[model samples]
Each structure stands twice: as C-alpha cells, then as structure tokens.
Target: TEIFDGFSKTVSKCKFIPVVCGSSLENGGISNLLEIIAKSFPSYISKKHFKAISKQDNKEMQIEISENGNFCGFCFKTVLDQFNGKLSFIRVLNGEIKKDDEVLIVEKNNKFKVTKILQPFGNKIEEMEKGVTGDIIVLQKLDDISTTYTIGSKDISYTYAFDKLPQPVYSVAISAKDKNTEDKLISTLHKFSEEDPTLIVKYDPETKQNVISGMGELHLEVYFSKIRKQLKLEFETSIPRINYKETITKQVESRYKHKKQSGGHGQYGEVAIRVSPNKRGEGFKFVNSIVGGVIPKQYIPGVEKGLIEGLNNGVLGKFPIIDIIVELFDGSYHEVDSSEMSFKIAARQALKDAMTKGDPILLEPIMNLSVYAMDKYTGDIISDLNGKRGKILGMDPIPGGLTLIKAEVPHSELLRYATDLKSITQGTASFELEFSHYSPITGKLAEQVIEERKKFITAEEEE
Candidate 1:
C-alpha cells in the first residue's frame, strides 16, 4: 500500500503515471524497486531496450513500456489574472512536465522556465509540482506563449502542430476618443490579440485608424465592449477604407535632377529611369542596368530603397504602388555634392514623373464570399450582392432548407455588409469573406475614387 501511495506521489511530481501490472501467478512479488524505475521509464532507458519492454510475451498479464517518452503539450488557452499577471493552460500529451523544467515553445523558438504549475479544481487552483501525460496544468509567466505554440522538452525532435486558429474576416477602423486613451488602447489591443489568436490588430495607413479584425462583427464588438466595461476605455469605430493599388499601363522614361544647396555640402544628382507595367500580382521589381559606371554601385541601392519606400504612397489616393518594374539606366553625380541622399531624392522624383506619364491606373481588391441563408431570403441576398458589384458563381442547396450562395464581391462593398446581411436575412444568415485578387477599376467609378482620394489628401494637408 505504501508503494501505491509512493507511486502516486512520484507520478504527481513528474506529471505522468506509468501503469505496471502483472499476475500474481507469474513474475511473483515484483519488487517495489520497479515503481522507482517506472518513474523514469522511456526517458532514462535506452531506446533499444525501452522498445523491447513492449515486446515481452507472457502467459499472465504483462506491463509494457513505451520508448518515445511523453513530451508534448500545447498552450490551448491563456487568461489574465489580477494576482498572477498571465497564465498558460497547457495539456500534456506524451511526456511529463514539472514546475522547474525548461520547455521550448518550438513554434516561437522561445525557452521558458515553468515558475509555478497549478491544476484547476473547479473554481480554485491547486499547486502542482509535476504533471505527466493526460494531465492539464497551468503555468505562470508565459507572457509570449499563445494558442499557436507547442511546448516540449529541449531534447524532443518532433514539433507538435496545434490546430489552425480561425482567421479574421471582418475589420473595423477603431480610434480612441481622446489622445490620453490612445496609448493605453494600443497596448491593451496588443495584449488582447496575444491572448486570443482569433483577434488581430493592425494600423491601416490608408484610413489612418487602428483596425481590429475578428471572426465576425459580434466577436469584435464583444472585445471592444469588454474594454469599455472593464478597463473604462472608450473608443469609436467605423468601416475601414479599402486599400487600393496603382500600376502602370505602359513603359515610359523620365529624368529628374535634384540640386539643393544649403549651409552644408550642396546636394546635386541627376537620374534617368524607365518604368514599365508588370503582370498582375508580380509586385514591384527593380533592376540596375547602369553600364560604364553611369551610376556608382554604392548609390544604386539607395535608388532602389528610395523607390521601394516611395511606392508605399502612390500617385493615386496615396495607395501602394504595385505590379511595376523600375529600371535605373543612366544618372549623373556631382563629385563634391553627389551622395546617396541626393541620388535617393533624384530617384523618387524620377519615379513620380515616370508614373505620371506611364498611364497609372487603380486596382481594387475582390473578395470571395460564401453566404448561408434560408431559401426565403435567397432572393434578397442575391439582389444585394448584385448591387454591390458582385458576380454570383452559383447557388447550392443544402439540407434543412438552407441555400449556399457563392460570389466574388469587391472588398469596399463588403465593409458594412455583415450588418446588412443580418438585417436582410432577419438574423438567419451568416457569411464569410476572403481576399481573392486585384481587379482594375475604370470609367466613372475610377474617376470617383481618384477625386475622393485627392479631396482626402487636401483635407489632411490642411489639418
């Protein structure tokens, strides 16, 4: 009986339990020494001998051991406690874990020492020194740990992959009411995103707002509401502006000379570059074709870097410039004043001039949407989608009188669509949206977008 209690204590310390059973008729009086050895099984034993333990054949019952040793646990959930700071809820899969053991979060390439392990007992938590396979324990001070991380021992070779968390589809542009709350709100949003993988926080340059994306509208509303109630933080949010892109339609050559003389060395550089339209989705490409040392190699990277950064704010509506190739063919540099800074300024000026002559056009993001609703609201859903420049692929019928409608709609049209769909379907419909590809905007719609963008920029400049 002492052996049984000792075995339990040892198992509790190691965070795992090994079951060793044998018939009384055979292997009679297996010593308590076996229990001491069981605590270190698979880890302490040689791989060859450990594998052999499972092959033992006997007339009576046999206790087999495994070789791979339990060393698997993933951080499934995280919570913030007023006293504890941060806690990671980990479920052990294959190996034992102890309070002082060092485990690697293979995904994050981070090593953390388990400060304190606690096992949940209903509403309260009890300190646990060790937990073997099949035991769930909570560890503190795992601030960087998240649902995507897999915790294992240092020697483990295999990396455990946690299930893919849900991706955020609906995004809202959020901003604090006052400047004082902005810093605190940003910090809290980062912590919220770390705690919940489904929550995403990003700053949108186009809209100039901090955007928080989540699985659905309700999911994001719950998070913002919780912040307002618990943290006494107040913020307002609206649908974000669509991030459009500008690309060229033809190849054009342009030249720019940047000469500025101040108190210090005068800046003087001349650059000639060719801009060409690339295939959709090819992104931006830079090539230095300078021969006979038209431009020094050292300054060539400056031109490229300048062009790349310059593309972030495009000519049309300040969107990113994409799907274009810029070639630096010829340039002149002044011996006394020419430097990387001068060449960079010349390159940006040349690019802007070339883009103006290269027939720049706007590209909008299209999203593939899947809508699930009852048959009664199918007509209304189709009509609404069509009005938003959606192209319906097809409609499939499912069981329970539900219809699945698939369509590709422009991203701008779907910003406030979640609420609209709910109203149209009377809360009986749900939908999902994912980015598909960039499509060209032309005619009156393109003109309207350009005008709005110019007006926005003018207002911002005045502010």
Candidate 2:
C-alpha cells in the first residue's frame, strides 16, 4: 500500500512514470497492472476540454468534455478481422451512442451507421446496446473508417486535433513470391496501411517496386509476420533502390539526321541542338531558336516531345535528367518526305548525342536528417553518421540531457539507418529525415551506383 501511494504521488507530480512489467502472452502481472492503472491514472472526466478545428470557419475551437453534450470522439485504432471485417476502436468523449445511430466522420465528411457497439476484453468481445461518455467501444464493419478520424453525432462540424504520426524511417521493397498473388498482396498491404497510419505503402514508379516503410525494422517485421500468418502466401523483400537523377555539367552541340530511302516517300529530317546545364531544381527547359521557318513550326512540338522523352533516360545511369536547357537552333526538312515522326526521331537522337558529350553526371537525393539522443551517445552517433558520408550541420543540446544532431546525408547511404542508429545508441535515440535537395555524385561511389543500375536492368530484361 505504501509503495502504491508513493508511486501515485510521483506520477501525479509529473516527475516519472510508474512502470509495471508484464507479459501479455503469459498473462503475467496483468491484473496488477490493470489495478494500478485504475487506481493511479487520471479519469477522462478530469480533462476539461479538447482542441478542435471548425471546418466551417477554418478556425480552432475548444470542445468541452461533458457527458450532457453531443456525442464526440475519435477512432484511436483499427483492426481487420477475417470474419468481422474492419473494426474501428473509438473512445467516446461526450454524450452517448446507441446501435443504428448515424455518425459523421469528420475528416472524410461522410456518415456511417453504427451497426454494432462492442466492448472488448482481451480476445473476447461483448455486444453492447449503447455506449456512454468516457467508454471505449468497437464498431464492427466500418470498412471506410481509419485511425485518428473524429466521430461525432452527425451535427458537430469540428475535427479534433490529434497528434501527427512520426515520419517512417525504415523501408523495404516487397513483392509476392508467386506472380499470381501479387494483386492480392498489394490489396492486403493497403488494408494494413489503412489500419496503421504509421505504416506507409506505395509503388515507386522509378524503381518499379512496391515499397513499404515504417518506424523501424521490428515494426515492419511485425506486419510481415501477420501477413504471412493470415494469407499463407510467400513474399520477398529487398532494400529499396534510391531514386537518382542525371544532369549536365557543361554545354555541348550535336546534330543528327533521320533519313531512310527504302520506301516511296523516304523519311528525311535533320536537327542541330545545343544542350547546357540549367540552375539546379529548375528542371528541363526547351528553347526554340529556329529563325525564318528553318525547322517548320509544325514539327516544333515533335522536337520538344522528343527532347522531353530523351530526358527520361540519361546516358550515365538511365536515371531521369533534370535542370537542363535544350536549344533547337537549326534543322533542315524535305518538304515532300519530312514529317513529325521523322523530326521527333532526329531531335531525340540529337539530344542523346549531346548528352553523351555534355559532361553528364549523376545526382543523388540528399536528406535533411535530425537525430535526437542522450548526450553520452553523441560521439558514437556522430562517428556513425560520418562513416555514412553524412555532413554534420550542427548540434544543439536539448532538455532531459539530450542533444539534437542535424546533418545532411545521401538518401542511399541512410537506407538502413534506422537499424544502424538503434545499434549505435543501444535503442536510446530517434530520428526524422525529409528530402532536402539533389547533389552531384561522382567517383567510386557513383560508379558503384551506375553498375548496380546496369545489373538491375540486365536482370529485368532477362526476367
């Protein structure tokens, strides 16, 4: 009793959290943990109000937490059941809810009928006719519902402000072992992503792979384990490829002539173009310098189209080219034989020739990375980042004996950083990264990337 009282006092003072060790699999210390929570945790009624956004006025407002008000709550979690379909777990913050009541999903602005109100106890669930304020209930068969969506009694037009999900740091490119099950695998992954907002699933068009990202390695492993157990399907996972770009470093002029004399009207088109580097991030620019009807106006679109298509695959590594200017200054056409198709071929060939001589280089995406860890592990963390080719920007000491280390690192180098950081800090740190900019890549590292790309292309062709 004395220990319980002391723990309660310390928790109430916001000094520390009381920890209760338990194993859910064995049901060890479960009852004691529940008892402590019931006795020590603050009641929901004690929370005065919740901040929410008014959709009508686009302003923030406070919603009072009272049992007499209209029904208001939010979905905190969701689960997919084979037999019951999607089940959304909601915490009722105000008023009451009954079976068949229509509720509004604030974010989606859609209404859904509550078919069954259920109360969960471990693995068992009991049907309830109604749920009152402060009760956590499950609604069955809410297929379109997702976590963090506000639920109100069809009248409130406010969305409760919820904490945002952290950025996913670890990623893997996944595919079904059997091609026949690929569609099913993708559909199931989407369902899982809907249930857990932190789990991100997307198809990378550049890499041509289905990628899934999450908080860390174990987080992804848990989903994969669940998927295997549920679907009984074979799956393959690999490290995702970084999306690199290509650009020119200098100006070069090239010419190409498309001509064929095997048919009645032989194709004929000739083009001269100058390619030069543009300011970074400006993307591809097309400038037509044709004068006095040289390279007729009708074929200009075809030339531009050809140039854009040429940018799709750079000579260095077949990566998309960016931040370059192509000037179509001179060309010749046979009035009887020249056509848009002929000009397109000529322009495409010209751009390819120019790129090969324009001092082309590969560009890799850089990420702005911020790591938070205890001060004692700062040296180890910095050392690891240095080894990954990370450029340290600065470090600031934060509260709680922690430090925030800021750096810019190439995206390819940090592919497994989530696991690496955990190992370096003994799982005592967290990090977030976002796309910063594209930087030039050269030398041995660039050679390795280009070689890997070649291997991937070869494997894809063989497949």
Provide the TM-score for each candidate, comma-separated.
0.80, 0.83
The models' CA-based lDDT, in order, is 0.80, 0.91
RMSD to the native, candidate 1? 11.7
Residue 374 accuracy (lDDT) in model 2: 98
Give the runs in model 2 whose Cα sits over 4 Å from its true position.
1-16, 21-29, 53-61, 66-71, 93-101, 129-132, 153-158, 227-230, 252-275, 285-305, 326-347
The Cα error of candidate 1 at residue 310, in Å, is: 2.3
Model 2 per-residue lDDT tens digits across residues 156-237: 9898888778999999999999999999999999998988899999999999999999999999999899889988989999
The residue pairs found clashing in candidate 1 are 15-130, 15-131, 15-132, 16-132, 70-94, 70-95, 71-94, 71-95
Which ranges of candidate 1 are over 4 A from the true structure? 1-68, 261-264, 374-377, 396-403
Q: What is the lDDT of candidate 2?
A: 0.91
Best model per TM-score? 2
- lDDT string, candidate 1, 326-438, tens digits: 98889888878889989888898889888889888899999999998999999999999999999999999999999999999999998888789879988788887788989
